[model samples]
Target: MAIGVAAGVSVGTVISPYAGAALADDAAGPSYLLVGGTGSSNIGVLRESGGRLIPVGQPVPTDTGTLSITVTPNGRFAYVAHTVSGTLQGFRVGDDGTLERLEGAHLAPGRPIVGAVVSPDGKWLFATVGSVTNDVQTYAIAPSGALTHVDSVTIPGATSGLSIPVVSPDGRFLFAPSFIGATMDSYAIGFDGRLTPTGSQVPTGDRPALPSVTPNGKFLYITNEGTDDVSGYRIAPDGALNPIGRFPTKAIPHGMAITPDGRYLYLPQTGGQSVNGFEIRDDGALVPVPGAEAPSAPGHLPGRVVLSPDAQRLYVIDTLTTTGTAKVFTYRVKPNGGLEATAELPVDTGVTFSDGATGVFASLGPA
Candidate 1:
């Protein structure tokens, strides 16, 4: 049977045979895992062939209930943060793009693990512990891709707050967004991977959800889920957040991503069930991308937005349904940072075979 889903100006087809065969490619690419509140914890391997997303292997079972995931820069390791268990799990990527469980399955620090990221050097891992404790934990990543506990420091106002941590591209700073405190806190990273607060917290909008640093390492963007806006900040040399501007967006701007060239920022509005694009000016102001808002189907809670490594395609994950379904939206990014939709591919996470919460595209790296 063939399934037809809306892609922007036209309809895209998903044939069962093609999907099944695509799932058998040898170079099906690295496995992308998705974790959430449901019990659907599995890894998806995708191959970008013929300008299409081809699934190569079957999903592997990861027992840890992951709320978020981050893959290492080398794509050899994937770390998942479990919200309920308050731990992190490490998995090694095999040749076939399958995941092999490492020794560190559930390393908990007495708090819920909301976000985790590998350092730019791939030497250390940091995770945000979203507990009343309000601490960011550090771990030394072994050569075998295992994590060893290193140290942790508490954010002064992070207690009972949702601190989302992100490491800068230069490997010099780590920024954590505190929802309850309404602040974006900065920390200077020591050579040994220890974090020391930089004594600066730039206040942000209500309920800041996720923080993203531009690829150029010059600016930071945070999504305010409660306010339906995105706040931009200029990165100071001393690891300080200098407010650039706050731009209004659709309702519930949950997930966001900056293009590879650092010219465009994509926001996925969960409540509005739409995707909005913005052009980044040289002065750190965001101008809404013309003709970029695409309506989504009902119950399509867009969770995360990511661009292809080549910067040719845009992908959004829908999180409302239990069956994993990713709305793969392709776009032709113009020279001026505007976006035009090319096609949309609806991928089944092997849940319904027709439509269901299959899995989310957690992170996208090169093939």
Candidate 2:
């Protein structure tokens, strides 16, 4: 059956495949989604009806490229990383999942910021910032969706670029991979949103970049963009990382998303224009999924791959082209871990910026 999602319309129970167990939610049809785009304009929000993304309200403007977006667990607010400008922007999520601009809700933590992620508890926001600043910034989230800067901490022994930051599903640790440093940095997130390093750094293959924690919170994975591989680690109780092993990939793997059940890991290789799948073992090792290589068109530059709330669909955000014809490619995850392309939704990004590409995620919630 084709997956149809609605946002802010009604609440229903959904048994998500990603969570292994039956995760109860009020609704199966989630309403709103937001995608950040680069160009002269700001990012836009999309209303989900019948599983498709349609523009809503007005496009909220931000400086340069809105590289990444993070929404609160309750779906009340969204925060975006304006990478080019080294800043953060906020929006109040409407009841129907619409986005309303939040004025005076910007955070300037210095230049060359990369990723922004809100804590699972929805109390804190964390982001990676300036290559020279060499720090991760944390902020306290206000009830109105505005952010109040709290603290910043540098990755241990970090001497290069920082890609993005990921908080463990347990919200106990924040993982930031230093691109050139070849080190996986860990920080213990305090109850009040402050940060403290885990004392030691976990080494990686090459440019140990993007880090994603499994939904089960048992393991951590980092993509080595410089070495064309990925590394897995065992998460210690004290938020330390112990290297499991390294796995090869198609090419230049950047972004990764795991299934809700914690059974699979999906990596989107921007340079390869293909997604590689791996079956996660019970012990935190990665095994390649047979016949799970999903490819896209040549210039798609598919970077970010995300699964819908129901885990029935995976959306690949193909960064914009020079002529403004980029698209968001949708696929249906087969029963056997393979992917079948379903739809290529057109997006108007106007122009492409080489700095970085942004992505959109379709939301599911009650109307």
Number of the predicted model whose lDDT against the real structure is largest: 2
Strongest candidate by TM-score = 2
* Steric overlap count per candidate: 11, 16
lDDT of 1 by residue, 161-233 (tens): 6676789998999998877777888999999999988857788888888888898899999998888899899
> Relative to the true structure, how large is the alpha-carbon lDDT of every model?
0.67, 0.69
**lDDT (Cα, tens digit) per residue for candidate 2, span 155-267:** 66637465577899989999887776787778899987899888478789897666889987889998888889999999899889999999988778877879999998888
Candidate 2 Cα outliers beyond 4 Å, as residue runs: 1-29, 39-41, 57-59, 158-160, 320-323, 343-357, 360-367
Model 2 lDDT, residue 71, Cα:
82
Which residue ranges in model 1 land beyond 4 Å of their true spot? 1-39, 158-160, 322-329, 350-367
Q: For candidate 1, what is the TM-score?
A: 0.83
Q: For model 1, give the 10-residue run with minimal summed lDDT.
A: 1-10
